[model samples]
Target: MGFFDRWRGREQRASIEDPRVPISSPNIITFLGLDAISASGETVTIDSAMGVPAVWAAVNFMSGTLAGLPLHVYRRTDEGRERVKGGLATILHDAVNDETSSFEWRKHCFDQAFTGGRAYSFIERSAGRKVTNLWPLDPTKTVVKRESGRKFYQYKDGSRTHRYDAAEIIDIPFMLKSDMLQHRSPILANKDIIGLAQAVTKYGAKFFQNGGVPPFVIEGPFQSPGAMTRAAEDLSAAVQKAAKDNRLALSLPAGHTLKQIGVDPEKSQLVELQRFIIEQIARIYSLPPTFLQDLTHGTFSNTEQQDLHFVKHTLKRWVEQFEQELNLKLFGRGNTRQYCEANVDGLLRGDFKTRMEGNARAIQTGQLTPNEARAMDNRKAMPNGDDLLIQGATVPLGTQPVMPVPANDNDEPKADAA
Candidate 1:
């Protein structure tokens, strides 16, 4: 069962009644907002002019969407509206609302030029050259002719002369948030898809120091998406209360006593005990998933600029695979995959699996099979023939391998007698 109905009325959330309605199994849409909340390092921002519709969307999300009260909104565009397909993906941007006041923003008003029509024209002649490749910056040179008094000084042959526009100033913005779409990097055409990418890419680009090498930092305007978390907490609380009234504990996992894992403290008897346990675990381990999903590949101009699929699936896979991987470490060695098995043999300490259950006595004692200790491991191993969709085909790997070569193995040893 879902956390809350997140509905305004009967017309809204009937489709999302199952939480997994439009999504695949093991996926809970209500958790998306929460997953986004928990994710770290990589983040995208949304800023727009005349944001009334956008603001309306945000408020709707906060009020009911994530609270398990599935409400209907336009998730997908065009003919898809008649059906309750997917809950329109809602991303919380703390600064999107306040962006208008911060900069010399550009805006498009419903002009008198479109007098008889309700829509703006897409056929208008453009100003700046169109930028096709958005990444690593465009190399096109925009020259400004020199003209005024002391506008820019030119120094040549040890002599300094007052000259105008002597220097060509290049502006490179891969990702950015600007009020004016025209001012945005990539010089937005429609100010919808490309614009959003410009802002996100510009902002995302800044976090990379020394040219996107290592240590990709999260450069934030760390605005909080209070609605997403608040909704989850409220729903959890409500469910908790219901459980308590019925005298039921959230779950009785091993090593936890009934008293320690007492009945929930919220107020919704409608939730299922199994669902509650999973949801709670999800809440607790939220960071290991959404925070890690990378939306670097897909772009605003790519797919209605909808990032929900990319972000949601990426996070879900990361969490599921990561959890299974951690479990594999508990068994350690013995018939594990070449890489996985080596990781557990008291070697490969740097692998993420090492951080999972390395110190557990069960793993150290070798009392369990690599697959048995972590029941989830078997599913996550390198895909065998049966699992591959295309038989006999192998997934490609980078020449730059995922695993590191030991420095000792890489070192050139001194010449010595055999």
Candidate 2:
């Protein structure tokens, strides 16, 4: 029996109705603000932060990469594990594809996980406790609450509240909280990084506005009040016009001086600062620096390693969370052996030549059989290919026989001839 079936039976036995309907209490949605305000006083919400290029790039890269992956269902039995087929696999692999839903399942998961560090979906069940449809929930409005050590989800929509038991709701969280019920948002944790990003943008703008020079002071000899005012205004107008016209020359009157005051962007290391910020953002998302297109320290060999690292470190974390959630909700907790998994090997696989060479080595070394290697290339197996083969010259260790001597007859004949 499924988790929902067990819960439903208990509820019926206790004569307690499921709280699917809204209560008579006032419909006041409690506000649990992130309080993520930058040092520059900019309110950093997911939407606003996404407007920043670095944040947008990182988030989009992660989401798009994860969305393109294929999720598979597998079953483990006494006969050994095999890819699952039929209803469950169909739902995970194809039914959740783009045609059945407004958005692709992967994309839906990406948006929720990236923005709020959590993704929620409802499993609509039929009369027989069979899943009829799956729909995403707005992570912003879905609240997780625990009472008497039992956790439930409450979704506030306009003036109504939709409640769901843990079995009916799919909650994929990025990282767990202390209570293990709510998730922690990445965006909220690193407001300082976002603030620094804002500063970098502001600095770049000012650099251009000042005609590629930092702020400076103009000192001139004493003059009549009217003359000084007129001279100052004239210099200001000329500099402003030059800036607009992209002119490098700024002609000033005699006794008037333009001394550049602030440190140049190069000398002040603004470029390095920007690069560092990119790396920091990448780190927060557990992505390699190259994934963010920051190749300051990237090399040919390191780039390949980092790609593998991305699949292993970054994508694996998210995929594992998804697998466990799919197993618990879709397959039910009763079936401990059957589970869903993301086919991360697609991302981890190497180029054709490299992969073929590695597989050849595996076969030659007796690590893999011929049919096993063929399966990786999507080719049909040949007869007798399942047998493991090793080079004929090689013998089993400690099993070589000693050759007997045949010199007795030769020795007697040679003795007579001498």
Candidate 3:
């Protein structure tokens, strides 16, 4: 390999897409779904907990966030695996890190290329090789030390079968394929004169899926189940209280507020009770608008962070004030977190209309999906009436029907595969 050829090989590897690799199904589904949903939710790529695709859902938690980048890699028997992987990764890693392609964008591509981080199915035709930007979960690096008797180690890729530990060429089911193993399932994972340790193999699988470079532990997912549940529950309760608290915060008239009609305002906590009431009254009687700028009013980082209680209290205070002054009903909580209707409608001073107009323009300009357009229509009570079967996409629970979404005639894309 001459210096110039090597240099050209490196230079040839920009963010250019490899023509050889076939797009995996997982990759297609994620990117398309994200495009559809983003239009519907009016959400950008950075929203937390917004799993545009299963890319976020694939990882247990925070690692999912980091995994949003497309990892360019070249794998195969071309005797250029290391060089190719390194070269491609260099351009891709930098491009992604610099946000030339946003985290969401790279993630979108990865899902398309690897079928949602399953397998790096790179098929070769002639004296060819396989390569991809994605890999099995483990992709873990390893060091083997032959301590006298046996030789083997486990692979860690964060799948059930990643538990294979052997000094020899161990085979395991790929996450994408989930059926066969590259080598063997239960390879050697013995310590000292040790034979096989199931736990050892499991550890290897974990190490591989997350990352094996330095081999670190990812404990964040432990809190995901609990924290997500609590956050949802807490937010639900707080919104319900916003009616009364909102009125009080805006100092609106209580007689017009809805909370006084069914429940006693005095029974609730001072801050919370006040806020909800204010919000409700403000809504009923049409009050002026307020804005929320994400301001860092303080200097120190060690101070108490904002949590459920603080949010609830703040909501309550705003609602309570509105009720005291406006004497109107406002702010009801249920599935969606909505602002006070009347306050929003009247006090918006045509801001709502203007925003809607802009949203419409965005839609007309090839930025919206049918589902999104339908949702927007439903919001304004302007019926589009296009509900075929169910709302939202399919949930993965092993067995379920996956009917293809009807594509538009005019805008229907010429699918590469079909």
For each of the candidates, give the backbone clash count: 29, 0, 89
Ranking by lDDT: 2, 3, 1
List ranges where model 2 is wrong by over 4 Å: 1-34, 97-103, 221-240, 362-372, 380-393, 397-418
Candidate 1, superposed: residue stretches over 4 Å from native:
1-194, 199-360, 364-366, 369-418
Q: What is the TM-score of each candidate against the true structure?
A: 0.13, 0.78, 0.17
lDDT of 3 by residue, 1-418 (tens): 9998887776544332543222443334333434323222332232221222222232222222223323333333454233233433453444433334434433343332222222111111124321123222222233222334554434434453332223122112212233222221110110111111122234445433423222212222334677646644553344445543552222222332212122222343433532343333223212211211112232233122332232244333433342222121111223122121112222223356665775566555556544555454345423553333333345679767868988787896668975
Of the two candidates 2 and 3, the one with more favorable lDDT, higher being better, is 2
lDDT of 3 at 317: 45
Q: Over the stretch 1-418, how does candidate 1's per-residue lDDT look in tens digits?
A: 2434433333243345553244433224433422222122222222331132322232222222122212121323353323222211111111102232101110111111011111111111125421111111112212122244432323232343322232221122222234211122211222233233233344334423213222211222323667445644554554456554664444322432212122222322322332332233223223211222323333556443233443354333432332243223222235232111101122123345653574244444554334333432323433232221222234566544467766676678789988
Candidates in order: C-alpha RMSD to true structure: 30.9, 9.9, 32.7
Give the candidate number with the greatest lDDT.
2
Write the residue-wise lDDT of candidate 2 on 317-396 in tens digits.
88787778878898787887888887775553547777788888889889889998998677899999998877666679
Superposed by TM-score, candidate 1 places the C-alpha of residue 135 at a distance from the truth, in angstroms, of 28
Sliding window of 10 residues with minimal summed lDDT for model 2: 23-32
Residue-level error in angstroms, candidate 1, position 174: 25
